[model samples]
Target: MNMMSYAIVSVKNNSDKLNALLMGMKGVVGCDLFAVSYDDIYTVVSNVKGANLIADKINALTFAGVIDTLAQQFTLLPVRFGSLMGSADAIVKMLERNRHEILQNLLKVENKYEFGLKVFCDSGKLMEELRLKSGAGEKMHLKPSPEIKNSVYRDYLDKKLAEHRLEESMLAYVDAVITEIAGRLEHLGAVNNFKKMVSEALIIDAVFLLERDKKAELIQVVKDLQRQNAGLRFILTGPWPPYNFVDLDIK
Candidate 1:
C-alpha cells in the first residue's frame, strides 16, 4: 500500500519518546500512525492507497494542525503534502540519505516558531488615495503640440501611460509599507520572508520565524501596524512549526 506522509521529525536523543508520542496519536482520516527512522530523525507517516490519498487535503489547514501538534513536542521538517514513499523502509533510507541536512535544520528551528501575515487592501480605494497624494505635486505640462493632440491613438496611449504610472506608484507605496513593517520587526530580531502584491486584495504576504516567546509582542506589533495603516487589513496566523523556514530538501 502507498502512504500519505507529512514530515520527518528530529527525535535527536529522544527517539523513544517520539515513538511513544506516535503510539497515542492518530493519523489524518483514520490512517495508522507509524515511523521510519534513521538514527536520530524519524519520518512520522501513515499508509494510504493511491485512491485513498484523495481524501487527504493536500495543504489543508488540518495538515498544519497535525504538524503543529508534532512540532509542540519535537523538532521537525514539514514535508509538502503528497510526499509518499512505498514503505517504511524506503522512508528510513530517505532519512538516512538526508541525515546531515535534517540535523542541521532541526538545530536551526529547535526552539523557534513561524507566523504568517497577510496585508490586504481595497486596490481601487488605495489607488484613489495615491492619486490624491500624487496630485499635490505640480501637474505635468502637456502643451497642445502635435505630440499632445487628442487623437484616438493619442488618447489610448495616454490612458496606458497613466495606468503604467499608477502601477509604478502602487508598487512604490507597497514597498514603503513593507520597509516600515520590516523595520518594526527588526527590533524583535526575527527572520522574515515577504512577498508584495500577491493578489489584488493581498498587498503584502509575509512570514516570520522567531522565538516562541515573541508571540504576544509580534501580535502587538501587527496590531500597531494595522492601526497605523487604516486602509489596509492585516491577518496574522500562527506560531507554526517553521514550515516556511525549513531550508532542507530530502535527497
Candidate 2:
C-alpha cells in the first residue's frame, strides 16, 4: 500500500490528541487516517491502494477536506494533494531529511491564515473609461494634419500608437489598484502575493497570509476597497490553513 500524505503538522506534545482526532476521520477513498511522526512534528497520512489513487475532483476534495479539518485544531503545512510514498519508513526518512525547512515553514505560519481575493472587471468598459479620462479617445479620432492625412504609413502608425497608449494605460490602472491593496494590507502586517491581469475579466488575483485575530479587519478592509472601486467586483475567500505561505522542498 502507498501512503498518501495530507499535511505536516506541529503536534508538539499533543500526539495523543492528534491520534484520537484522526481515529474518527477518513481520507481519500475512505481510507483510515493515521500519522507518521518524527520528534514533535507529524505527517498525517493514510493507506492508499496504488491503483485507487486517481486525480479526480472527488478525490481532490476529500484530500483537501482532511487537511482543512486538521488545520482547525493544529498549525500545519498542507502537503500537495497527491503526495505519496512507498512506506512509513520512507516517510520518516523524509521527515528527518527536511526537518529544518519543515520546522521553519511551520513556525512562519503558526498563527496565520490564508485568504484569497479576486478582482473582476469589464474590460471593454474599463478601457473606455481610461481613454476618456486620459483624453486618448479624442486624440485617436482627431483628423490627421493635411500633410499626413492621405499617407497610408502615417495612418497605420497613428493607429498603432493609439493601441500602445491604451495598453500602457491599462497596465498603469492595474498597478494603481494593486498598490492600493498592498497599502491597505500593510497596516495589518499581511504577507501578500499579487498577480495582475490574469485574464480580460479577472484583473487581479491575490492571496494574503495574516494573523487569525485580524480576519475581521481584513473583511472590512476588502469591503472598503470594493466601495472605492465600484467598477470592479471583489470576491474574497478563506481563513484556511496558510496554503500559500508554506515553503517546503520535497525531493
Please provide TM-scores, in order, for all candidate models, with all chains considered together: 0.90, 0.94
Residue pair clashes in candidate 1: none
In candidate 2, the residue pairs with backbone N, CA or C atoms under 3 Å apart (3 or more residues apart, or in different chains) clash, namely none
Q: Assess candidate 1 and give its lDDT.
A: 0.82
Top-lDDT candidate index:
2
What are the RMSD figures for all models against the true structure? 2.2, 2.0
The segments of candidate 2 whose C-alpha lies over 4 angstroms from its true place after superposition are 136-150
**Each candidate's lDDT (Cα)?**
0.82, 0.92
Give the alpha carbon lDDT tens digit for every residue of 194-230 in model 1. Answer: 9999998999999998888888999999999999999
Give a tens-digit lDDT track for model 2, residues 19-58.
9999999999999999999888799999999899999999
Please estimate how well model 2 matches the true structure, expressed as its whole-model Cα lDDT.
Answer: 0.92
lDDT of 2 at 168: 93
Model 1: how far is 1 from its true place, Å?
Answer: 2.3
